[model samples]
Target: MFNQLISFLDKGKIRKIARSHRAERYVKKFSTYNHVVVMLFTVFEGYHSIREIVLGLLANAHKLQHLGINYVVKRSTLSEANERRISTVFEEIYQDVYNRHQRAFSGQPFKQ
Candidate 1:
């Protein structure tokens, strides 16, 4: 299920955006895509802390491989990425995603 949802994301587009934002500059193992994946996992699972996200990923390390996650992220790595990465990269990605899917949402009515 998670893998299917992740498939909706275009990895190339993500890398292109990251490049434009220089989000991957000076990065070694952890790339912008990896950070995005980890953050999404954290949100979907309702994880409350860096420690929980790390441990959760660690526990599901085997399954994550199918999702293109080659390794278990450390708490410090996640923390550092969150602190240093440009927020605009994510904002642009969100806008692109919304634009691509806007037609599906066009007919829906919203309630205040």
Candidate 2:
């Protein structure tokens, strides 16, 4: 179910935007995909801190690959990425996803 939900994300589009933004220049292991997944996972699980997210992800590290997150993230790595990476890539992805999915929720409870 979770995998199917995440499958809706256009990874090609997200990666192209991330490349344009140079979001993965320094990190070899942590790609934009991993970063976004960790963030979305944090939001979905309601993790309040990077430490909590990292710990939770680590505990479920083996399952990350199934969700298309190829690597286990470290707290320091997530912190560095958050501090240095431009947010526009994710913003663009978010807009794209919302635009694509908005129609599916037409009768659902949402402003749009």
Candidate 3:
């Protein structure tokens, strides 16, 4: 189910956006893609805190592999990524998705 929902996201486009924003600069193990995946997981699972998000991911480690999440995200890692990464990258992605599906949403084409 999670995998299916993430299928709507274009990984190539995500990487492109990350590059444009330099979101991966100085990054080590955690990439922008991983960050995005972890955030989506947190929201979908209704995790109220960073501790719960970490534990939840750790608990479902085996299942998350199919989602391309290989390592368990540490609380610090998630917190730091949320702070350092440019929020505009996500805004651009959201706008892209919204524009692409705006007609379906409003029954009319989106205006620029």
Candidate 4:
């Protein structure tokens, strides 16, 4: 499921944005889209916490493998990751993504 979602994440663009992080200690291996960034997006979009995200992932873990997000970080892992890193970076990334999505759909209309 989310593995297919991972395929939709532009790896190079993510890596490029990731490079601006000044804190190397918080830097993670970017092999998947199931990270703090996505976690924040999920929360900002109304998911209450990491538990919800984990549950969603668990319900579709098998599908994630096919999408290439094979790393199965639990709720605890996600919470810890989000906590350790500063929130501003995650905010900026999510904001950029949100803006892009808005732009992409700016002139969209109903097809039905």
Candidate 5:
């Protein structure tokens, strides 16, 4: 189920955007994919703060690989990425994913 959810994302496109933004400039350990997965996981789980995100990820660290996440991210790293990376990168990914999948929904179409 987790893999299926992530499968919707075009990783190549995401990576291209990340490169264009130079989002990995100061980061050494975590990749852009890691950051996106962490953020998406937090949103899907309704985490309210970074502390909760860290704790939740730590608790599930063992199972993250199943979701294509191999590293246990540090709070500082996640915080830094969140602060430094242009948010438009993720927003673009979201828009791209939504545009690609919107036709599957039966309700009123989403427009962004």
Candidate 6:
């Protein structure tokens, strides 16, 4: 969801996604790695694909900004970004979330 992205991007470096001089495409710096970052996040969060994410946005299309992306990202683009970018960093971020949860609950476990 684009609304969720507002918070997610705010708390993450995706706010700094890079674009090439030759193209309007927003290429996350690690290339294929970036694809994996998005793919994994979507999957882990229970989304099936970029299409699902895009469909979510389309449902709330009136609220989305002028992204110039009128359609779902092609599977090829998804595959290419996954193949070309550095996704391990994203996996680490996901792992860190689990680690933080562990720490929060293991020692001074919340009273609730």
TM-score of each: 0.88, 0.85, 0.86, 0.59, 0.88, 0.38
**Candidate 1: worst-modelled 10 consecutive residues by lDDT:** 103-112
Task: List the lowest-lDDT window of 10 residues for candidate 3.
Answer: 103-112
List pairs with backbone clashes in candidate 1: none
Query: In model 4, where do residues sit more than 4 Å from their true spots?
Result: 1-8, 23-32, 36-46, 95-103, 107-112
- lDDT per residue as tens, model 1, 1-112: 6776676677888999999989888778888888888888988899999999999998898898888788998888788888889899998776776666666556664332
lDDT of each: 0.82, 0.82, 0.84, 0.54, 0.84, 0.44
Best by TM-score: 5
Q: What's the candidate order when arranged by decreasing lDDT? A: 5, 3, 1, 2, 4, 6
**Which is superior by lDDT, 4 or 5?**
5
Q: Residue by residue across 22-57, what tens digits does model 6's lDDT show?
A: 222456332422343345446645777667755654
Off by over 4 Å in 3: 101-112
Q: Which whole-number lDDT from 0 to 100 does residue 10 have in model 1?
A: 76
lDDT of 3 by residue, 37-105 (tens): 888888899999999999999899988788888899888888998899989988877677676666556
Better of 4 and 6 by TM-score: 4
Error of 6 at 57 (Å): 5.6
- Residue-level lDDT of model 4, residues 28-101, one tens digit each, is 65322446435634654467767777776677566555554666676665666666656665565555555655
lDDT of 2 by residue, 1-112 (tens): 6576687788898888788888878987888877887888898889999899988998888998788877677788889999888878888778778777887655764443
Residue 43, candidate 1: Cα error in Å is 0.6
Per-residue lDDT over 1-112 for candidate 5, one digit per residue giving the tens place of the 0 to 100 score: 6667788877788888889888879888787878888888998889999899999998998989877788788788888889998888888888888888988657998765
Candidates in order: C-alpha RMSD to true structure: 2.9, 2.4, 2.3, 6.0, 1.5, 7.8
Which ranges in model 1 have alpha carbons more than 4 Å from their true place? 104-112
Screening candidate 6 with a backbone cut-off below 3 angstroms (N, C-alpha, C), the clashing residue pairs are: 30-85, 30-86, 31-85, 32-81, 32-82, 32-84, 32-85, 33-85, 33-86, 33-87
